[model samples]
Target: MAEDHRHETHPEIVKRLKRAEGHLRSVVEMIEAGRACLDIAQQLHAVEKAIGQAKKTLIQDHLDHCLDDVVGPLARGQRRAIDEFKEITKYL
Candidate 1:
């Protein structure tokens, strides 16, 4: 992870990831304790969704703020590059 830009949503993202981390730990413990598979799967799904949402927020923030800074009267090539980068992040 690199930090060339910081946004207001960053703290919120960290909070979400922390919550996901806690949930993951709980899932691990539940597995060790012989919890029902259904219960463990539900917790794992929550953690997965939490992490996915955090990633989406981070990428959207970067595109909205960081790229916006570079969008002013740039040459065509640079703009295309930025667009390409934005497109690639969609896969994340």
Candidate 2:
């Protein structure tokens, strides 16, 4: 992934992703250890939420910084492009 220095949230997002990675690993262990399904599901949910938050942060930072830097003043077309990009993030 490309890092944009203008966004201060990059490091925070990385940390969140790392934490999610760890949780996912633990979930694997729980499965191997025959942990209760509910317990494993709960941890998996946490991992999913963490990753989702990281993705949200990344997209928001791109909108807040990258879009602004690339387009000084958004024309109607540019605004439409930006809106489309933001719309795509809704699926994330």
Candidate 3:
């Protein structure tokens, strides 16, 4: 494990989660207020998307930074490229 420098993206991920949390709170309120189903669904979708994007970003950032920290030196020594390693992790 590379000296884990996870703090870099943790703040960003937290911010995203906070936004999702607020949206979820609003959604709960909306439900209690008897808001239209469409309105609730849209807000729920927004919350879902925000969380999903945050997860994807967190994973990609970890793979990009930490994987490079661990594999970059070796790949450089072997004259091999590790971009694919980072790029492919985007699907996770």
Candidate 4:
């Protein structure tokens, strides 16, 4: 197997996750401060979107680098497995 692609993108991914974490903390603080619902919801939505985008980037980077190297010339069954795995991630 190829070396994990996470090594390449882990720092960037962690930065995104940390930003989302800060956004989440702000959302909690907003709630505690009795901020307007709209403001709180906006921040929460930003947090969710940030985390979602990070997840997508991580998955895409893995597929592009790690899987391409490890699964070169994939057979029929291997391709099906990859497709199914992708399908399952739609819910994420």
Say which candidate scores most in lDDT: 1
Best by TM-score: 3
Tens digit per residue, CA lDDT, model 1, 1-92: 99676789999999999999999999999999999999999999999999999999998888967677857667887779877888788888
> What clash count goes with each model?
0, 0, 0, 0
Q: Kindly list the per-residue Cα lDDT of model 2 for residues 1-92, writing each as its tens digit.
A: 99736568988998999999999999999999999999999999999999999989898888877877777787897688877877787777
Candidate 1 Cα errors over 4 Å, as ranges = 1-4, 73-92
Which pairs of residues have clashing backbones in candidate 4? none
Candidate 2 residues lying further than 4 Å off, grouped into runs, are 1-6, 74-92
TM-score of every model? Answer: 0.74, 0.75, 0.76, 0.70
Itemize residue pairs with steric clashes in candidate 3. Answer: none
Model 1 vs. true fold: TM: 0.74
Query: In the order shown, what is each candidate's alpha-carbon RMSD?
Result: 3.8, 3.4, 3.6, 4.3
Estimate, for each residue in 55-91, the C-alpha lDDT of model 3 and write its tens digit: 9988888777767676556635463446666666677
Question: lDDT of all the models against the reference?
Answer: 0.90, 0.88, 0.84, 0.84
Worst 10 residues of 3 by lDDT: 72-81
Regarding TM-score, does 3 or 4 come out ahead? 3
Flag the better candidate by lDDT, 2 or 3.
2
Q: Which candidate would rank higher by TM-score, 2 or 3?
A: 3
